[model samples]
Target: MTVAPADDVTGEYLALRTGAGVVADRFEAVWIRGADTTPFLQATLTQDMSGLAAGEITRAFLLTSKGKVRALLWVLVGANEVILLCDKGRQADVLRALVLLNVNMDVTIDAVLGPVIEVIGPTAATVVGSLGYDVQAPHRWAFSEAGHCVAAIGHIRVDLPRFVLIGPSSDVVRNSGGVFVGDLAADAVRIEAGEPQAGRDVDDATLVHEVGALDGAVSFTKGCYLGQEMVERIDARGRVNRRIVGVVVGTNVIPPHGCEVVQGSAVRGRVTSTAESLYLRAPIVLAMVRREVVDGSAVTLTWDGGSAPGTVHELPLDTFASIS
Candidate 1:
């Protein structure tokens, strides 16, 4: 099916919820191959990479020495090499960081300038299945006859399974009976799922624990890695000053990024992402708010001259699976 235009955000949004939407160029891949690839990654990433068998994938974080997030990655371990997939426009950063950390290790990092297609929504599995690949369990991947790597990445909505097909051909999605969606819809689903985007929902200054998706990306039992000390320190404290939270505005107006979220006179947080949620029929945002702003708290979002009344809620927004 033809992809929806920018104005038709709801068209693409609904397509993904009801069927499938193919999102391309949402991610970039880096191929790392060498005798020391596994050990190199195990020492650099927040996730434990030791004993990661072939055909498995895991979400991991590459952090600065201070425990700030550098890039969120999905490491796909193949027979001879491991592929690191990160948000679009981040391959260079990850590559450079790895190179600096190589030191005496022997590894070759090359950017894979291939087509990255994300098949998302409820029927995403069916679309991939029709293409002759078994719907691999979450965090598992299989190579297609055409050499395209099909990885069953986790979901945005619990019912909406997401798959990433990374390889040379964009034709994999053709005639697959899936709707093509624009970036807006895909981003909305991500916000609704409480998944953070690299430069948008998170950045170099953001800590790994401040985001809600930590349980999957972090390995508390793993050996030391870059930024491990801060992670352990914060884990011991069991709290952070601020965290990424969701704000729902009961109106059509969408707040711009950086709009201040206020409770009375205090500026509690700033909105990092905004979307007109079709599920709630209102505008929603992902914001890094002070920890005291608990769920179900009433708040107001204010910008230069415009303000909208909203309420704070935990990430994923509770109404994700109840689309009507």
Candidate 2:
């Protein structure tokens, strides 16, 4: 199997870190509309969905009753409708779950089909600003062939400048003055940036806190929604059984997924994603490890019929992490 989703992972990674790269987006869009759009979403999503003026976006979660993540959502409060971004393959599942709980609420949930483009990397803001809008805004939308075009902060960091341009057209991507990076390369960049991909680093079994999404994705002040109780419980507890973390394998080869992360003979956790980090110039892996294994701890990652000693690290990895 390939270590990355792109043929030229190293080049794509370099482009984003140093310059700019227009990444082809694979995420699907969900359009939620009606008079009750604001209140309905306010109750269900983790973000305070009210008072979001037009051209603003908020990261929110649709969670299970047990507080496991159903979907990591990015909500754009538009004029005609409220747009949601969800996992590409599992969008129907997201919509179905939303519809099931949407009783007595005047909201319409539907899937949007089209190509989405993300112009990201350090120079992402420059590329996006040239396209005729402020890259600083959290939520903004335009028009396109497949659907409405939207721009927002691409990832969860302050230092790295990243912006996502979601629309039906590839024209904006071409005109963005950046080399096009595919999903594989984008995945590597995302992993390096500590951005968790749903169904990979996180799943339906994933609690919001496990991936460290409490401050950004889940809202404490918002009214009751599905899975609020569990979220609050986890918040009160202040830690999780296993939290996502970064690992630096001794081997130069990228660690394969499903590799066991062990401390002594007991399996503490497992690696979820790994990549040949261009910035670190070493192989890095993202693992879901028990909370007992503190940062800077030593662990063994067994993969590909061999085992390598790896040092534990915090999220956002090392090379691309903000020092300031």
Candidate 3:
């Protein structure tokens, strides 16, 4: 992971929150092509992919039959094919999962080699619009004359809309308008939003609801999918032992990832991601905390030699309400 300087990161973070910032090559795009594309994905992924019109996108989870997350992806419905967007380096896992689930279906999965551009901020639409792509609302998408796919994506925070442009990175950056930033800015925002990354914040061992990803990524009303039974059972029961939550540290120090979150002597959770937030002027992190530790609960994060005091916050902290 590459990081910008602290000052540069702060500027970039502000650009993403107040205006717009473009990040290239931060995500991966995999193309699932063939006539059976929708049905194949609909049968495997947790979300309903059927009846998705062209220029629409939905976030979904590819899970095992036992309901453990295999991949967290955004399914972009195209006329002839479906584009799956996921964290960089997790494409191979997603491809393999789709391959195993193919059965006798007529579908071909291939990695799309191109620059993936992420446009973040409130004016993200305006920036992408200048590039001749009209991504009307969050979850809607459009394509460009030069073969770029532009999808307006929903963010954890309501005010900051995101747009993903998959095509030529250089061309997208040169032609589009926004402050260009690196991974650090994105990490800060993602941590603050309590968004879980596939391999980092979550893994094959984790369940969808355990990370608070069920609402957008899992569909109860949809037809049977790979993990439907486990999902439905859990939904009926109505809770997971642990869930993703925000932890605002009392000081400015960013705790290293994988630290134990303790409520007194009891181990409550583990820190998944952390960043020094410019907006909050403190260290913020995403952690998979035990259910008993609700928002506003005070907790101590401990590692080998250091510990920090923090307060648990629900996902998508309320600090963004002014802009939201």
Candidate 4:
């Protein structure tokens, strides 16, 4: 709600890159418990969840039988329960799907409903450190005596060293003393970082193969999980019809959501998300283009009346070192 101003977003983005910034709120968590919780989730997720240590987190996805995505989830392992992190209100859908399989499993699904404050940028470590918790590695989480758990992890839109302070509220709000960046500013950094977001860049029909960067999301070695058959089959067949890629817009024009990316008169792709990049000083976008769209290929992003010339670039559009 009123996270940042449009004109000031660029400035806030720059600050997030060089120093520290906090997003006081934006995420929610769902609680999955009862003795069978671990095996229940492990059987349904793309990531292996059976061996998570205390205060650890991992990325995963819940998919349909046809291999389409239902949700992108960040699973946090605590002592007595598991926390599933996702975009606000996404837990309800996840819970609903999960309840169908609860026939014999001793599991209870509930929402954590916490305020998730994100501390990000190169200085993320410093900011959280001052708050009496150490988040040294990505996926590593630690909780303070006050019940606040901070996990070093990226959001749906992965950028730099990002960490989330999650609880009933955030100590970072009172202790970190960092500058606050709103959703607008945080979003610009996301596009610049080239991470596709769930519910925005991805949808119910979107498959996991379309999203770039599976560093920690999927486990090919794991046993059967929901939608695993399709995942394995896709790998064996070697490629999906379309994959998400980045495009550097040639003009100042921002591609509206769902705008078509055309190759001559043929529509080859659709723009899913866009942002004005201060680093590039131009608009950049995430588009699901046909796998045939070769790297460095030139394309046109067509909106209502006009089109902007753009070049297809691989994901991770902006270099991490460049921002520093």
Candidate 5:
């Protein structure tokens, strides 16, 4: 769906003024299923899939042999099919990798690049509620047989279920009933929630724990999956060395991605994402800081333009939680 300007804002719309959802700028959808589904995925992904039930959504990482993440994926399990969602740019590589690894397995993979639409807000439920679909708020995935839609709310990744509304973009926009948030607003919400974007906050060189996703994507109890050994070792060591943490910049001058986070003369980490917080009334950021520097300590963000003083805070960095 596309965003349109509106003068009249409902409580739902007001909610969306600060609240936001994602529009599938571009994505690749792939289907994998068969008798070897569990084994195939178990061997390739970082999460345990043997217990995944139909209608459940699981986040996982496709890792290299050396245990570095190659792509972040959202797996949606249907009665007889498992759908994999990955970045459009990485689709070909991921599909190729999976295909090469599908040795004697009874699994099949097909790249389905369709229009994926997302809708989120506090009134997100109200919008979906009007559509005659009951979507459980985030982490829960549901499909609309009649509307040809699939949705999840409040999910760290794939926060909204994408609907395959085969028609004009305008038509889908009208039908979605939720506001079409810009890329900036979406990034802001993601940072506030402490979620990592695949390429921006994580990439091939990123270990799962360093991105603050060890608990969500990696399963320590699962059998050996790609990159499981290194991930397990990091867990056993009781530290990840470097981690993604939130920083509240004192000034409005936003630090660009990869800008250095400094304390005294030492380089502590680098900024991965930054956005203005409508709720918090200050500039907040997500950065990959050396583990030693992330203990709610004060620091400075140095960039080409200037420098701003800030502090390192934990993820889902809830400045509001303390008050509530």
Candidate 6:
């Protein structure tokens, strides 16, 4: 991944110049419109919208009544509209859930895809900057006045990198001035950041607080949302039975998702995702480990016919501190 100076360029434009190639990863952009938009959102997600200003973006979770995550969303609020970018696989389900809950509200939701292009990498901002767009510093998401473009600086998961999403594809590529990075590379970046993928790190059986993303997704002061009670209860208790952590493996062998994590003879957790780090020079993984065993200490993974040495570390891994 290439690194570049921060200036007027956006991440997307910078990615084009770097070696990152773009892929047609399915993504949906949903528009939230109606007088009840704020109320509707407050009741549906874990983030508080009471203080949201236009152009503000937040990371949040859409959950089931059982407190399990249905989807993870990156939300951007506008003057009269709120936009949601969620996993393509769960787009329909999320839309249906929102519609079912908006029976009496003045809100309308529309799904949008295709028109947007996702450009990602460390130098992504430099490419956009060259196009005359001023990107916000890393970890924050913002939109540029260059028509339909949104620039975000952060990790995809375990990989802390910058990314930009430009819309109306035609105009975006023409002006991006950078190379395109495919979804595979993007996925690799996420694994490097140790950021949890929604369906992978969090699913129908996963709880919000267990992922160490409460600060990014849940608001302690937010109004009641679908799974607010359980989340709050976990927060009040000061501990969750399971927590997501980064694991650095001793070998180049990458573990598959769902591989059991073990410490001696006890099953501690399971691997959620794994990849070789381009910058770290080792294999890293994101795993859901028992809270009691999550200290930054030595651990091991037992697989068929083999064992790999590893250690449990915090989320957003140390590699991300500079970018995130």
For residues 239-280, write the lDDT of model 3, one tens digit per residue. Answer: 889888889999767899999999989999999988888888
Give per-model CA RMSD: 2.0, 3.6, 2.6, 2.6, 3.8, 5.4
> What lDDT does model 6 reach?
0.68
Models sorted by TM-score, best on top: 1, 3, 4, 2, 5, 6
Which candidate number would show the highest TM-score if scored against the true structure?
1
**On residues 198-275, what C-alpha lDDT tens digit does candidate 1 reach at each position?**
888889989888876676678999798999999999989999898999999966799999999999899988999998
Top-down lDDT ranking: 1, 3, 4, 2, 5, 6
TM-score against native, each model:
0.94, 0.89, 0.93, 0.91, 0.86, 0.83
lDDT of each: 0.84, 0.75, 0.81, 0.78, 0.69, 0.68
Q: Native-vs-model 2 lDDT? A: 0.75
lDDT tens digits, residue span 1-324, model 6: 233343322342324324343434445667789888988898889988878887777778888987888887877777767888776577788888888878688888877655655555555566556556676655455556755646463443445344546464634455454454444345555655556766677778888877665566788886688988888788789887988888888888877778889987899999888766555667788888898785678888877877788878775554544442
How would you encode candidate 4's per-residue C-alpha lDDT over 1-324 as one tens digit per residue? 113345677657866788777876556777788888888888888998877887788889988888898888888887667877776656678888888756798888887666887877888788778777765577777777888777887654444788887773543456464567877678777777776677788888888988856668899888999999988898888889998988999999888888998886789999998887877878888899898888899999998888899999987777667544
Which ranges in model 3 have alpha carbons more than 4 Å from their true place? 1-7
Pairs with steric clashes in candidate 1 = none
Clashing pairs in 4: 3-182
Cα lDDT, model 5, residue 228: 82
Clashing pairs in 2: 5-184, 6-184, 55-139, 56-139, 57-139
Better of 1 and 4 by lDDT: 1
TM-score of 3: 0.93
- The numbered model that scores best in lDDT is 1
Tens-place lDDT digits, model 2, residues 1-324: 012234666677767777787766557778888988888888888888777876676788888878788887777777757878876676888888889879898889888777656776667767777766555554455443444465665566445656656653666445656767766566677777787778888898988888784676677886898889998888898778989998877778677788999998888999998777766767888888988889999999886678888989887775455422
* Candidate with the larger TM-score of 4 and 5: 4
Candidate 5: global Cα-lDDT? 0.69
